[model samples]
Target: MNFKKIIVSAVAIAAFAGFTGAASAAIREVNEWGASAQFLYWSAQAPNYLQNIGCYNGGWTKTGPTSKYQVSVGTCANGDTFIFRVGEKSSFDGPLSVMGSTTDPNRGSIDPQEGCGDANPRQRLMTDETTCSGASCTARKCVDITVGASDVEGESFTQVSHGMKYGPSTATNNVWIDRAFSAIDTSSLANTRKLVVPFGEFVNNTVTKNGVTIDNLTRHQVVQIYSGQAWYWQDFGGDYTSLPITRCFRHAGSGTHATLDKTVMHSPWGGALLTDESLVDPLTWFNDSSSDLMKCINTIDGAIGYADADQIQKVGAGQTYPNVSAVKYNGVMPTRATIANGEYDNHWAVQNCYYRPTDAEAAAVCNAVKNVPSSKAGFWATTCEMTYMKDKDWTYPVYVGATCEAGPSCSDGLDNDFDGSADAADTDCQ
Candidate 1:
């Protein structure tokens, strides 16, 4: 929540470097870059966490935005600012699933060797630093941020989606989350929901035409639409609109995209998805962050995508996404109650936090991120506040910390009386 801008004049590198060597050469400040700005912000602005991370200002400044990654900076007592967080790339998680190209390929579009031969070959990473060299970079500009600007290191964002979900947030999908690495498994903050651009384009799948009902997409319908099986507005049930469906997806390496891949397109480990965008050859659009995707969704008709439930709906009516109608998935809405109860699972994921320096400090930061107040964090359910847990992304919900009864007082294997038995065996559930 601390987006207080810190105005720093850029200083010459030589002088600052000399001062750094004499004053703070041994310090290597915390730098994190990964998914979800909201998730990362929880840690960067955590009460009393700045000092623990070698930061002293206890304040934060958000870089505009990124195609893949963005930074939220923090300051230390010595006037030095560090890259507190950046969105993760999942280290090329999941399969790259690109098809062979012809005269109209994206790889050659950039530099023939740079961009992804599949999407945009010139794709880049989401990490940026101060405008100049680190020693005195702050002097020239305390914090220089360029959102959506091409960091020579980033891959191209211009790519057509094939309804193929990018990467899931799981360690298995995002291997960096494996035990070998120091990571925190912060459970989901909120579920994700369906989004259509050109505001109010959906207007409810049942705009009511000729006494016929056009319903919002079901899990099956979602897959059908994304894979090109259902190509038009009439494909679902009614002749609501003549517009052909344009599948919108997060650029590769997006956790939300991965969640849709697992929970909806391929539910219950149901089946394989169409990997080749060419097979569907459906019209597609891609975005970097929640805001970017929302912007894309609102401006383009027949465009449908997904983002965090909170991020997608937190908008004030008519303030943003003014025309978009609420579309449902399988007749159930993605409410906190529904997501917590397992009715809507497509948009939620464990908010895992990873750190490189060491595990102890990593645990502390991760704990703070997981513990951010739901009110302050916006739409995210606290890790243990939910009533159920799932074995997989969209699997059956299992009652966790059930004390023979569902009550407010007991949870997550809590044992008030020192009894070894906590869940179902406890008197509450009994």
Candidate 2:
């Protein structure tokens, strides 16, 4: 069977069903009601949000085969469409416009020619070539949302604050933060930067190693390994008694590296670097994508690396990295529950939805995109988090403030422990 023809047929069928009233009146939204929204998000869990959009209430349908990274297209009840472009959290440097110029159109652009050379359209989108030129880009007809690479969360607000500080852009930036980009300083940003909405939580910067047994590590031990203080597996209680621990890092521009730097190596506020630079030998360190990191862990015994917890889980589930698994930090495994509850101390940045705050047209489009029916509260990805951790159903609301709290009231006679502490608060609450 021709896979290309099959994928084309499948997409056409889905779209036709969407418009043919077979999808329900709620899904037949008029174009005037709202414009489509596009999002360029960089988070390991970005696909969870995209897949959830398709499975949201059956009003939308996901057409492509499932993959760890895929562009998703969904039509909502009000005829409003949603397009998602996602990438590795580490590669997300800034908005797509930050790189593309007329002189170098492909600078920030996702070229199907290069990224999708051998893959079919559907496979291309799923495999990170989510963008294309002209009519070939069928994820969404209108360019309402666009995103950039690596971890959008890893970017400090300092990067985008300047552009929004003075005033709104003269033209449409055309980028929407689906999962909001994490900002280092929310207070430093202008109030008008309202469009940079926060949503969802993630456990990023997880340490992983091969299936070899090792003692549960503390943040201190993890730091020791990366900072070059710990040389042998014996230093960290690994099975490889004589092997020297190999260090692997993501690229500098990677959000994964940024989050690991801030959460594991840097000071609390990330104002200063924290690693012992002199000890870290660049020659011995490996730097590449998470997939590449997985390969490194598989091939190089006593190797250790970091990536998003969700990415690790997805890879493990796919059995793609059979030799690798997530390493426990402080004796607590990085699970959906630990990440959601903030128990996993080395949590990554909150995913943010970045958009042009002052651009009314863009805002309207984005608002419509996110505010689809049955999407105001949760998505499939969040639901997966609940299911994966065997917790109650959850929602992926727009990011507002710290989901993790502390202080006196945190120890109050309420549900401080998140265990339904109706009367007596758990000691852990304190």
**Which candidate leads in TM-score?**
1
Off by over 4 Å in 2: 1-91, 96-212, 236-240, 267-283, 312-318, 359-430
lDDT per prediction? 0.40, 0.35
The digit string of per-residue lDDT tens for model 2 on 167-252 reads 11132532222122233222221111111111111111233235335536667766666666677766654434556666654434
lDDT of 1 by residue, 237-279 (tens): 5646666666555554455655555456653345334333332
Once fitted onto the true fold, the runs of candidate 1 whose alpha carbons sit more than 4 angstroms away are 2-28, 37-40, 43-48, 51-215, 267-281, 314-317, 345-347, 356-358, 373-378, 402-430
lDDT of 1 at 405: 20
